[model samples]
Target chain A: MLVLKNIGVTFDGGTSIGSTILNGINLRVCGGEFVIIIGGNGAGKTTLFNVISGLLRPTTGQVMLDGKDMAKIPAHERSQYVARVVQNTMAGTMCNLTIFENLAFAFTRGKRRKLLPYSTSARRKIFAEKLESLGIGLEKRMNATVASLSGGQRQAIGLLMSVLAPSKILLLDEITAALDPKISDSVMALANKIIVAEGRTTLMITHNMAHATAYGDRMLLLANSHFQREFSGPEKEALTPSELAKVFGEV
Target chain B: MNTLEIVSGVEIGLIYGIAAIGICLTFRLIDFPDMTCDGSFVLGAAISGILIKSGCNPWLALCAATLGGALAGLATGIIHSFFKISNLLSGILTAFMLYSINLRVMGGVPNIPLIGAATIFSGASAIAVLTCTCLTVVAIFTYLLATDFGLALRSVGQSKGVSTNYGVNIRLANAVALMLSNALIGLSGAIFNQHQCFADISQGVGTLVIGLAAVMIGEKLFPCWSYLLIVPACVVGSIVYRIFIGFALHSEILGLKTQDLNLITGLLIIIAMAAPKFRRRSC
Candidate 1:
């Protein structure tokens, strides 16, 4: 479970230009809950994820991960508690490393790194099995450089990597936004299945309203630097894109 | 070549190979084309020469040299990371400053002579049957790289975002990588000073080019997927590159003087840089 209590983030644009990105925002995700956040441009959605992932520290409140205050933890130290996928496909994997090597790195996440001499074969086999579960042909290309992977393939791998470690929370920041619709659907379906099967708590941000409605158990909308609305179950299902848009004054 | 010449060439090659591996590690794993190797190379030599002349043991001198290199690298890493300086600029600035630092370390000398001091390769064949020894060190390094920390460092080079997502301390990784890289370079410098019986500050000049050349040559020759093969190939490539340079300098046909070494190095770098482009065209 994760909780953000009365979080606020302020930016000093200049001596004269001061702006607050998030103001008194509160959010909670129970264990095994899937939360989709829908927002238009500049809705502080990504900022919220950034705050949660320890990329940005909130000025006013605390970020509690499993009841521990995590606002002071550095981004790299947060890997043990949170794993995230960014909108940029290349942001989630090392492009120069082979698929299996990347997975090996992921498997050893949140641990002290050492130099061990062993053939990558054993680890490659394990990664292959995991890849096969994604139903992606990445299992066969364990030795392939991530540079050669398609955007969708990379995103799928990124999703899988985030869940590879036993982190308490997974953050998806429009991870499939760059892929083609078909690939996007496939990646989403895979993510849905993986998150559900693993029973991992997830907070996914999306530009697509339909995805917000269809994928997760809960939905929240951001506007004016705060959560403007929250919906769940049948209420979230009954809401249409136009109605959702109206709530944010987009319609 | 005669056995003696072959042995000498191989020994020299292995020494350079160690430096090349250090250079390649910073390049491939940290994604930084760190030029501090040039200054750190000389720094190592200077430190080792001073210590050895002062009656320090050869191993202790080598350790001191490695530490000196690590400090130099740490300085460069701090300038780059904290000051938001570009990688290339950070290396260049640090290397430039190291010229003065090396001078201070050597008590204002342009070079230091080892004279009768012992070296790691002392009593070794000109053919340097030290391959087995070098291989052991290489194996240890390779194994360390396969560990989680090494993977994190590699990830930093590959993708900063991903590495951070995995909670890899990028700044720490960068610092450690640079330190390790320069430490190895320093070790090579110490060895080189002992082998030649002298350490010249100018020896570090164009060292980065030599390292890049070795890496380029290794990738060209082996072009393998495995790090085990690629790492050794880099060492071999460094030696081969050195041999070719040495032969070119020694050849009567070239009519080149020792003072023209920098000119020759520059030309070699141009050729190396262009080789990939030429290969693309041919393909």
Candidate 2:
């Protein structure tokens, strides 16, 4: 479970030039719940993710992850409990390294890395099996550098990396935004399958109306630096993309 | 060049080649352009020279010198990681501080003579000893880079954010890398002191430039995308660079002087760095 209480972020706080980006934002995410967030430009969705992930310390808030106050925990340590996939495909993986190397990195998440040899043949076989299951055709090119992969492939790898290791929560920030619609659909379906299978508590931010309506057990519209609307259960299931878009335009 | 000059060139090359590997660890492996080589190189010499002069064991002196260099690297890492100073500035400050520390370690002297001192190279042919030492260093580094910790360190160098997201302590990895890197440079300095029978204050003047030149030249010549070959390539690069310098110095028709060595190294680095760009353009 993840809980954000009285979360607020102000740039240059208490100064004449101070500007509040997020104010009095509160949210609670139960375990195994898939939550989708929709917002227009600069609605502080990514900022909220940043605050939770410890990239930026909130000006004021208590981030409770499974009853632990994560305010003082640094980003690297926080990652043991929180995994994330960034919007920029390139930002999620090392481009110069082989795909196998990137996966090796993910495989050891939350574990102490020692002087042992990295990625035995058996481990490579396991990685290849995982990739094959994704149907991404990346199993054969495990040694190839990630720079040669397309955007959709990279995003899929990013998603795979987040799920490779267990964490208290997973954050996906517009991970499929850069992919073509067909690839995006498959990636989203794959993400949905993984999250459901793993029973992971996930928060995904998107601008797509259809993705907003189609996925996630709960949907939230973030506007004016706060949760303007939240839809769940039968209401979320019955919500149409056109109706969501109409409400999205009003705010 | 005569056989003796060429052989001595390789002997010197083998010793400095260890330093080149250190440069490779920082500049290539982690993409950290560390300037601590200039100071840590002399720090090693100073530590080993003073310890040897005080009747300490030669091998122990070498180890202490390496530890000193690791500490110097730690200083730079702490300053950069904790204080949020720029990476270049962190190395520069550490190197600058080390200048005075090196003098103090040498008992306020600018140089120390190691003549008649029982060094590790005392009972052996300098070339054979240096060659063995260089190969061992290369092997150790090759092994180290293939480990899980090496992957973590490399990831930190490639992308800090992604490394952080994957639970890598970037600051810690950076510090460890700098420590390992400067430790090798320091060891090279200690060996150089034994090789030359003296340790001068200004002996490390162009150490970073020389190591960088060797690394770049090695990559340009071999062009291996694998990490396994890159470590050995740095040593090869050093030997080649030294041989070329020997040839240049010996050529009477070229009319080049010993003072031009730094200028030549600078020019070589420029060409090596720009070579890739030119190749990319042609493609």
Model 1 misplacement above 4 A: A13-15, A117-122, A241-251, B1-8, B82-86, B129-133, B250-255, B278-283
True-structure lDDT of candidate 2: 0.91
Tens digits of per-residue lDDT for model 1, A1-251? 89999999888844478888889999889999999988888878898988888888777889999899996789999988898888999888888888887788888777666656323667767787999998877888888998899999999988888888888999999987999888988898899999999998999998776677789998988878898888987898898877776766751
TM-score of each: 0.92, 0.98
Interface RMSD for candidates 1 onward, in order: 1.9, 0.7
Model 2's i-RMS, to one decimal, reads 0.7
Worst ten in a row by lDDT for model 1 chain A: A112-121
DockQ of 2: 0.86
lDDT for each candidate structure = 0.83, 0.91
lDDT of 1 by residue, B175-221 (tens): 89999899888988887777788888898877787777887788778
Candidate 1 positional error at B117, Å = 4.0
Provide the lowest-lDDT 10-residue window in model 2 chain B: B216-225
